[model samples]
Target chain A: MSAAASSRSGARFWTWLSVLVLAVLCLVWIYPFLWLVSASFKDPLEIFSKGLSLVPNALRWDNYVRAWATAGFSTYMLNTVLVTVGTVLLVIFHTSLTGYVLGRYNFIGRKLVIGVLVATFIIPAGFAIIPIVDLTKTLGLLNNRWGIILALAGSGHAASILLYAGFFSQLPKELEEAAVVDGAGFFTIFGRIMLPLAGPVTATVAVLTFLAAWNSFLIPLVLTFGAPGQRTLAVGMLAFVGTNETDWPGMAAAATLSLVPVIVFFFFVQRFFVEGVAGAIKA
Target chain B: MSLSHSAIRPSIRRRLWADRWIYLFLLPTVVLVASYTIWPMFASIWFSLLDWNGFERAGRFIAFGNYAEIFADRLFWNAFANTVIFVVVAVPIRVGLALLLAVVLNAGLPFSRSFRTAIFLPVVTTAAILGVVMRFVLDPASGPVNEVLLQLHLITQPINFLGRAGLSLYTAIGVWVWKWLGITLIYWMAALQTIPADLYDAARIDGAGRWQRFRYITVPLLTPFTIIITLITVVEATNVFDLMLTLTNGGPFFSSEVIDIFVYRQAFAANIPRLGYASAAALLFGVCVMAVIAAQIVVVARLRRRVAEQ
Candidate 1:
C-alpha cells in the first residue's frame, strides 16, 4: 500500500523481518520439547555429548524400555485413561444436563441453584482437600478409580456448567417451542434439540475437561497415595523423576511418554482446541 | 379439613409436583456437586478445630489453636511473603509479554497460525511434568543450556540455575511463565479482536502512526479486559503449589516455598502430620481466594452495567 517503491520495499522488509523473528522465537519456545525427545532417544552416556543439534548419536529404544519398565508406564497410562475418560464423560453428562435445565426452565429454586454454583465456582478446591479425603474415606472410596473420577468430575464444575448455561441462553427459543409444540417432553427436548446443537460448547467442555483430568496431580496423589495401579500420569511421572533423578535419558523418556498422548490429542483437535480455549474464555 | 385450606395445600403441592421434572434432571448433579463442595467447606472449618493426625479419629479440640499456631509460625509468613513477591514480580512480566506477542501475532503475518500453535504446546502439557522435564533441560552439568553456553565460551563455569538460594524462585517463575504465556496470549487475542478495525482505520486516516494508534485508541479500549485478565492471573497464581513441589521441592533451602506448599507439607509430609494447622493455613489461603472472587464480582458487575449502558 505504500506509494513509493522504496517505502514499499521497506514495508515488505519489515514484514519479512517480523515473520523471521517470530519463527526464530517459536523455535526457541519449542527447543525444550525437541531436546526432550532427542535426549530420550540418545544413549544414556551420550545425551549431553556435544550437541546443539536435535539429532541423537544413535536412536536407541533403551530409554523407552527402561522408563516403561521402571515407571510401570503401562499401568499408569491405563489408570489415567480410565480416570480421564470416566471424569470427562460424567462432567459432560452432568454439566450439559444441569446447564440445559438451569439455562432454560424458570422452575422453583433455579435462581438459588445458579447463585450457589456461581459463588462457589471461583474458590480453589485445594483448600477443601482435607475434608474431601475424609469424605472419600467415609464413603469407602479411597484408592478407588471411581473415587478419583468422582472427586475430579463432580466437584467444582460450576464453571463448565456456567459455560453451557451461557451458551444455552443465547440459543433461539424457537427450537424448544417447536419441540414442545410437537409434544416433546423436557428429556426429549434436551436430548433431541439442545444437546445436538451444543457442538461448540460440548467440544469446548470435552477438550478442557479432558486436559484437566489427564494432567491433574495433587488430588490424584492424595486419593491413590499407595495404590500403584491407580496412579495417574502426572503422579507416576513424579515418582519416576524422583527415583530416576540422575538417570537423564530414562527420565526424559518417561517425560516424553507422558507428554505424547496429550500432544497428539492437541494436534488432531487444534482447531477445536483453539476455538474451545477462546470460546470458553469469551463465555 | 376446611375447604379453603384443603384447596390451597393441594395447589401448592401440585405446583411442586409439576416441577419434579426439573428437579429430576438436577438431582444427581446437585447431590454429587453439593456433597463435594458444600460439605467439604463446613468440614474444613471443623477440621481446623482439631489436633488429630491423618490416621486418628479421636482428637482434642483446640478451638482457635491452629490459627494461633499459624500466626506464630515464621515459615508460614515466609511462604506468604514469597508468594506475594512471586506474583508481584512474575505476573506483570507474563502479562506484558503476552500482550506484546498477541499484538504482533494479530498483525496477520505469514505463518502466524503455525507460530501460535508452536507457542501453545506447553499450555497443553501439565505444569508439574514441565517441572520434572525442565530439571534435565536446565541441569547445571548436563543441560543443553550449559552446553551451548560453554561452546560459545560465555561462561567458564556452569550456572547453578535451580539450586541457588536467590535464583531458584526466579527460575520457578520463569518456567511458570513459559507454560502459561500462551493462554494469556489467547485471552488477549480474543480481547483484541473485539476492538473494531474501523477505529484503527479512522486513526490512520487522521495521520496517526502505529504507536499513536496503539496509544490513543487501543489502550483505552483494552482497559476492562486488562482488569479481568489480571484478576484471573492473580487467582490462578495463588494455587501454584505443584510446580514448586516438583520443580524445586521448595528448595535448595526451602527458598521457593509458597503458602500452598507450606500447607501441603504440613498435612502430608510432616512427621506428626499437623492436619489441623494445615487446615488453618488453607483457610488463610481461602482468604486470598476470597479476594479473587470479590474482584471478579466487582469487575464483572461493572462490565455488565457498562455493556447495558452501551
Candidate 2:
C-alpha cells in the first residue's frame, strides 16, 4: 500500500513538473505577440525605456490612429478583404467543380489530368513568380487587385482539389443516383446535393484558403509594386516600415492591425484548419 | 477491325456528350491552371534561354547564354550555398523539436489547448509583419532580447541579430523556425493521434516504462510520418522569400540571401532587371528542389515497403 502511494505521488510530481515546463515554454512562445501588443500602446520613447516589460507606461491610442489613418492601413485592410474574399470564392468554385468532376466521372483523360495535377505540385510558386508576373503584366493585370486575386486563385491548388476529390469520392453513389432518377441534371445534382454534402470539406478549404489569401505577401507585393493604392496589408506593412522607419510604436500598431483580425478569425476556425492539414497529410 | 473501331467511336462520342456538363465544369480550372501554372513552367525554361530585360516584346534567343552566366556568377553560388545551409540546418531542428513538443503536448499536460493556441498564433500571423516586429524585438541596442541578455550578464555587449553579416542568416533562420514551428507542431500532433491507444496500454501492461514505450513503439510507428513531415519542412524552408525580404533584405553584405531573394533581386529589384538570368537561377534551383523531392519520394516508398514487411 505504501509502494502504490509512493508511485502515485511520483506520477503527481511528474505531472506538476511538466505543467511548470509547459507554462514557461508557452510564455516564451507567446512573448513576442504580447510584446507587440504592449509596444503598440507604449509611447515611442517608453517602448525603448520600458525594455522587456509588457506593461506600457500609458495606453497610446494615437499609435493605432497613426497606423489606421495617417499610415493608410485602412486602405490596405480594405484591399486585403477584397482580395482575400475574391481569391477564396474563386478557389472554392474552381477547385470544387474540378474535384467533383474528377472524383465522380470516369471520363477519358481523367488519369492524365490527375497525373498533371500531381506533377505540378513539385513546382513551387516562388520559382515561377517571374513568369507569372510577366504573364499578368501581358494581360494588363499588373498593379490591379485582380492580378493578385487571379495569381493566387489560379495557381494549381492541387491540394484543395485533392481534398474535395477524396471527400466526394468516398460518399456513396446512391446519393447521386437518386438525384439523377428524380430528373436532376448534372448542375442541379452537384449544386444541391454534392456541394451541400461536402460541408466539412468546403469549410476546410475555405479556412485554409482564407488564411493563405490573408497572409500572402510576395505575390501581392510583386503584383502591386507599381500601384500603392492596390497594396494589401501584408505589402502595406513593408511600405509602412519604409515611410515610418523610426516609428517603432506605430509599426507595432500596424503589425497589430494586420494580425489581429486573422488571429480572431483563426480562433474561430482553427479546428477546421487543423483538421484540414491533417486530412491533407493523410491524403 | 476498322468497322468495329468506327462503331465504337460514335458510342464514345455519345457518352462524352452525355457528360458535357462535367466538361463544362472542368473548363475554368483547366484554363486557369494552364495559363498560370502549366504555361509559365515551360515559359520559365524558355525565358531562361533568352537575353531579355522584360521590356522587350521578344527576347533574343541566346540559348545556353544565361545558363553559362549563372554557372560563373559568384552571387548565384553564394545564394545556392546559403539555401543549402538553410535547409540542412533548419529542417532537422524544426522537425525534431516539433516531434518532441508534440509528444509532450499529447501527454495531456494541463493547459495543452492554450499552449497550442499560443504557439500557433504566430503561424496565423503574417510572416512579413513578424519580420518587421522581430527586427525591433531583436534590436541590439533597445530590443528586449538583448536587454534581457544583458541584465542576466549573458553578454557584455548586445548581439546584432540582424545587422551583423555572420549572424544575420542564422538570425533569420531562428525567426523562421519561431514563426513556422507551430505548423510543424500541428503536423506532429496529428501524426501522434493516429497511434492507437491500445498499443500504449498493451505496452504498459507488459511492464514497459514510459521512455521504453516511446522508444520502442512510438518511434517505429512514427517513422512514416517522420519522413513526410521532414519532407514538408524541407520544402517549406526553401520558400522563405517574404520573411527574409522583410527582415534582412539579404543585407549586411548579402549574408542571408537565399535563392528566392537572389532571384527576386535580379528580376525585379535590380538597377537593370535581368529577367533571363533570374529565370535561369530559378530553373536551376527548381530542378534541384525537384530532385530532392523525388529522392524523398523514393526513400518514403522504400521505407513504407520495409515497414509493411515487418
Best by TM-score: 2
For A129-151, candidate 1 gives per-residue lDDT tens digits of: 88888888889999999989988
Per-residue C-alpha lDDT of model 2 across residues A83-169, encoded as one tens digit per residue: 999999999999999999888777767898899899888887766788889999999999999999999999858988988888888
Report the C-alpha displacement of residue B215, candidate 1, in angstroms.
Answer: 0.6
lDDT of each: 0.85, 0.89
By DockQ, the best candidate is: 2
For model 2, the stretches where C-alpha displacement exceeds 4 angstroms are: B1-10, B303-310
RMSD of each candidate relative to the true structure: 3.7, 2.8
Residues B148-181, model 2: lDDT tens digits = 8899998998999999997999999999988999
In terms of lDDT, the poorest run of 10 residues in model 2 chain B is B1-10
TM-score of chain A of 2: 0.95
Model 1 CA deviation exceeding 4 Å by range: A1-3, A170-185, B1-10, B292-310
For candidate 1, lDDT tens digit of each residue in B1-310? 1111244445656756877777888887898877788888887888889897988875579999988888899989988888888888888988999999999899888998898998899999977889898887888988998888888899999998899989999999998888888889998898899899999998889999989998998888998788778877887778787788889888887788988888889988888888888988988878876885787778789887998899
